[model samples]
Target chain A: MECTDFKLIVVGGSAGSFSVVSHLLAGLRPDFKLPIVLSLHRLKHVRSGLVEGLSLKSKLRVIEPNDKEKLQQNTVYLAPANYHLFVELDGTVALSTEESHNHSRPSIDHTLGSAAYAYRDKLLGILLTGANRDGAAGMKEIADNKGFTIVQDPLSCDIDTMPKEALKLFRPDRLMNPEDILHFLNALPG
Target chain B: MQNSEKDYNYKEYLLILKECSPYDFSEYSDNSIDRRIKKIMRDQGLNMEELVLKTRTEPDFVEQVVEAITVNTTELFRDPDVWNHILKKVLPALKHQKKINIWHAGCSTGQEVYSLLILLDHLQILDRAEIYATDISKKALEQAKKGQYFYNFNAEKYRENFKASFEGETVPDFDSYFSADADKDLLKIRTDFSEKVQFIKHDLVKGDLPFYNKFDLIFCRNVLIYFQGSLQSKIVERFHENLFPGGTMILGSHESLGGFFKTKFSKNGPVYHRTNSFHFKY
Candidate 1:
């Protein structure tokens, strides 16, 4: 699918993804129109205002979505700390406390797989630096759904296990450092 | 190429499940169920066909599959602020009643049940409350009934949640609730709390709501997210019918009412109250 045809942009990471996410957000045009979801792993059983913390650095409007909240353009949705976030067929958010996948809640695999199923080929999935293999299977799901996939270059990742796993599992459309990812986000059709 | 084949196998597995049993997975969203089946396959070291054969022949295999699919992890006072809100705002409104009936519909492992008991104990009304804690997983229900959990249960985080839940109030000694087991890494809930809770095995998706008496409060948290929108709405309607007029229903922090029931829920505590007279569907 063309970049303009994409309905949503999803990014998944764990451990060391904050810097890249913040940088990507900082580089986005204020008028960016595609909805973006951040499925970064977080400490469960503790209330952390990750969305609020990241909003300080992001130019785009960022919020933790309520269950069944509709998708909107030019906004960032952070998966809540303890729940698994899913994109529903109706383009709304659904959160589950179902058994954690890969030993992590807010699991990257759940988020990416559900988004792939929801948006089909009109989705772009980006996997970033992390120490676990959570996103590998989800990346494959996105590829299977004919969506575009990108991975942070393992050579440049601070913790390369996550991206390396994604790369090993399937071929992503792009493998670039944080700098190129930021540039790519800025260059997308608004 | 390989991933698409896996997807096909997942569908076949779901079909086999439906054909062999009274349950229907056709209404569920495929991705979540797909991942769960994959995990089952990996953990059992069996491909889809072998798994299907086991289910067809084995008497208890289907329950195990359902358990794996629906099981959710929970701990005491998770999202403590919400529990605190229930204590301060929700409980007081029902104070006029001489006895209170509470239902924790998806009470996996009974953390919430014990938490509620603790709160009631603090309020000195523990004797008057009867809680029915239910889950689809018999294994989880067995654990909840035992009231024993790993000693590794994050005391620091529990303390933090307690402080946040109580805000300015003096927090109870969180550790005092559980008696340490002789084994290094286990703790059992004090008998006082465990005695008041009743854990039952029940399925929310395909099974019927078996309660004869309407409840004063119902908690169905973090459970509906696995179902499709249609199933979620259907279950919420059933909950609405099962509740006494003005009885409160608490969903997970992230959960909300979908379909026509959207306007039925009032928003102060994000707790839905049934306003109309109740009627049983059957």
Candidate 2:
């Protein structure tokens, strides 16, 4: 698919993701137009105010996704605290609790893999700082469907496990620091 | 019935795993498979033969089963000591390579790529490096390309690890990396360094290698543990083919190339080099 047609961008992380996310957004421009989603693995009991916290660093509006929320360009959506977020065929968000995959409810795999299937070539998958391999298979699904893939350099990550795991499993298109990733996204034709 | 006489049904599960998914549980350690299978049975409420029968009749069930069995839990630089090792040993050794090609296979979301980029940027080699990051999941890839992460969730851990990695040195202020918007929804990466890297879609299981057997350095860390011995062996063979002569390969700290290949290369910490003749074990 044409690069401009790539409307969906998903970012997955768990532990140590905040700084990576902060660094990435610090480099991005306000005019960025893709629909960015954050799927962070969290404890069921923990209150995930990620959308509110990250809004401080980003130019786009950030909010926790609501049921059947229609995805829009230049907006950032966070997967709700306890549900897996998916991209519907009509370019809207769908939430589910249909059992956890890889021991995660708001699993990076479920959200990302499902989005890959729905968005196909118009998707971009990003795996950031996390402690587990939650996003690895989802990253693979993105590539299989001909979507762009990027991984934070594990060496620079606060917790290298997730990025390191991904580096070992799939061949991503780029390996960059958060700064570089921010720069790249800001430069996108959006 | 005797202990041995009880129906293990090993062959049936093996056939199912081989035919249905890319995983081959047959050659895996029996204890690991047994534990995983037990968990699968317990979770799905199925016995061994029943699970096999369900798989045969329901193709979608196989996807759930594969998801259950794979060891997908990971973090960014799960093992920081390994990164320390690379920083102290591997990067210094490769200082001479003018233009570097680094492949971070299975880069779920761009965390590890950012980590490596930070290292390269510090070492003054990032400009000369071309990092090829790939994965099988497009969702993860999309996240990786965007490079935006959750600030409040990861800041503390990032600071702690950053201190450990730098040993109290003044590191980059991560907060300065992103800008907050009016609605607090969108985050974008700055353009300065983002232009250097390229994000693409690639599947190692079924797709062709991009560099065509000429990567200068490859990082294939903890991913092989999910594959059975045969598939792991095949992937290692592919890695061997993808690397240039005397190129480097980095694996996870817990993982080793034991019995997978016969090669003579100096183990520089977690990184392995291809010295003389590189053979494809498969």
Candidate 3:
């Protein structure tokens, strides 16, 4: 449940959170080495634009990784549209089109829960401003696995349903504003 | 080795299944296969021990287990933009060849093959094309050969995908390509389209090339996502060996050749144009 011990960082969001995510990414240290995986609900029909949008502010290279691609350091990997991103027990990620869970491909729960399963206590799971309950069980899974879980402070969210849902399921390790989250990540030890 | 306890169990489960059946998923990406295994356990209401017992005792059940393990959740023209690119760009580029050869590795339920057929037919070049498809799952190969799918599962989506692929252009009579029975809730790819395709039970992970001749293009979309990174490279390398010098390899939209393979196959827009210009380190 500590910042420096994490091997991977997973962030999940749905509605009204892109700007917040951009802001957080804008503030992250350029030297950040932990592999960050972002799973956001997107227009599945549209093939492009999410990476372009996120790349505008990310300090590290933002890529929609190919399947079976290794989790690389100093990079931000965004889940591609129409695919579920599962973190493997090995140091790679696999993509699947298995009937979308919770009505969304690249399901946040799948990404977060799989990361929790793969990295256990070496993972940090974050739930951001969103209108859906897709990432609630995933945050609890992170907590159960002794990994750190951070839910954005509900009062500071554009839509609080996602964080509120997570809070209802289990107490996470931290409740912070986007700025605080950025600060905590930036201040992490080697 | 952090979760060695669970890892040990999965290794045992895989070994037991391999011992009893022809299927071997040991090289598959662990999370992808393990997650499917967990679902199989739930759906069949068998714990790991009982599952292994069933696999041992029931020869017939092994086939079902293999089907479940391999993910075959494809839809007709799942991504229209990619199909649009194929129809407009990739297919027409192969005009020099008198007869084009195509191989669809892991052709699940055959929707993609049918989609390509419809395109090639529109281009009026299907008569001179040799189409072959292969899948590890015999059941999936049978369904692909049958050329039928539940209406809700693929029929309705077929029309939608057709329209999207030809967004600006006036799409042809898409209905003419297929026959549908709403009462039976089944849709069949017309005999004309289905007959041109030859389905073979070729396992990409194990089986050798089903055809001796090299292909002009290989469509292996979304199939490599199931294997480990090492296997992904190996599979792509195998495709390189099976392709004609100037042939193109069309992978899933999100996939690409990594490491040394990147140098081997050069990406040109939507497809990887196989490059034979250099003979570098092996």
Candidate 4:
């Protein structure tokens, strides 16, 4: 199946990912049908700025979904701060105040791993720039689930710890920079 | 992945839970349930079969498993902004009431209970307030009754949150409601505050309301996030039914009411007000 045929797109990132994520969202056409779920590491005490910042750069609506909110196409759902966002089989988001993994609430590994399980081969996972290894195991989980996996190129990142750690696991399908990622997603089969 | 439960499926485990205990967690969100089960197996050094065997044979052990399944971590002023909103906005409306009944459903470990107690005290209505706190886990209920915490775990964060909630208001001295034992690293709730709260073991998913008071305010925060969507709706409906007309119920910040509840409660963030005439759902 073509990449765009996937039911969900989950992007996990931490440090140095803001610019890359912004670039990717900025370049996507307004008609992009794939719902992108973001599990970004954010300051737990600070909650308001991320979606507002990202929304300014993208045509698609960026949201911090309420617990039990249904997934919608043409929308970008950012994980709410201090909660883990799990994509349920019924296609609604379940937020939990459960223990943090890797010292991070809204753990990328959790969001990506759960999406891999829920969407299986219909999931496209993007592990982007960060200073930690949180998304690496999740990226591996995506690969193991036969889902499409993309890691942001280390050379193109502000901090390479995330993708570099991911590379140590199974090789992802693509190691693309911001521009390549944008273009590839734009050209995905409708 | 160590000593993994190869076939201890959630459905089977839930069935075991239902048979062995009064608790029914089949309506919990699947991923949270799955992870908690794995954690239980890994921590206790029990395989799937051993875990199931223990649960089926030992009533006490099943209760322990239920304790392990329930997530119980909460802090003083965990979400200070919400508390601030409650203090500044929600609690004021109830200040003049002759009597106030408040229930904390799934009041894990009691930080949230004391947080509200302080608010009631600040409003000078602590004497008139009837505070009932209940949780499914006996261990948590015991801790809630004690109303004590490790100072190391609570001091700094508690101070910070307390400050945030009373930002413009006169901040009380730290020694007023709690005392810190430096050598023991313990934060003991002053008896005056602890004695007022009546802690009970109530399961929001299974058991009847701990007491039927037609509560004026309810706080079931962070508890329902573990629940499945339909369960979330059902529990919200239950809270709605128990809420007095024009009463307020606060849920977790991340949680909101769905289903016909979207129309039943007037929402201001997680602060939901019971509105309109009551009707039985078909």
Which CAPRI quality tier does the interface of model 1 achieve?
medium
List per-prediction Cα lDDT, in the order shown: 0.82, 0.70, 0.86, 0.87
Score chain A of model 4 by TM-score against the reference chain A: 0.96
**Candidate 1 residue spans exceeding 4 A from truth:** A1-4, A43-46, A67-70, A88-92, A116-121, A140-146, A153-161, A164-172, B1-24, B206-209, B276-282
* C-alpha lDDT of candidate 1 relative to the true structure: 0.82
Order the numbered candidates by TM-score, best leading.
4, 3, 1, 2
List, residue by residue over A1-190, the lDDT tens digit for candidate 4: 4545788899999998888788888889999989999999986456558889999989899999988899999999999887899887788888888888998888999999988877889999999999989989998999998999999999988899989999999899999988888888888876
* Model 3 per-residue lDDT at A118: 80
Candidate 1 per-residue C-alpha lDDT over A51-170 given as tens digits, one digit per residue, 9 for 90 to 100:
777887899999888877899999999999888898877898877677677998888998999899888789999999999999899988999899999899999898999999988889
**Error of model 2, residue B7, in angstroms:** 8.3
Model 2, residue A103: displacement in angstroms?
Answer: 12
Tens-place lDDT digits, model 2, residues B121-227: 76778788888887655566677788765655554555455445554345665445434342555433445445555666665565477654578778876566445
TM-score of each: 0.87, 0.49, 0.90, 0.93
CAPRI band for model 4:
medium
Residue B157 lDDT, candidate 2, scale 0-100: 56
On the 0 to 100 scale, the lDDT of residue B29 in model 4 is: 77
Off by over 4 Å in 4: A1-4, A44-47, B1-8, B181-183, B278-282
Better model by TM-score: candidate 2 vs candidate 3: 3
Error of 4 at B95 (Å): 1.3
Clashing residue pairs in candidate 1 are none
Q: TM-score chain B for all models.
A: 0.90, 0.71, 0.94, 0.94
Off by over 4 Å in 3: A1-3, A29-33, A44-47, B150-160, B167-170, B179-187, B277-282
Candidate 1 chain A weakest lDDT stretch, 10 residues: A43-52
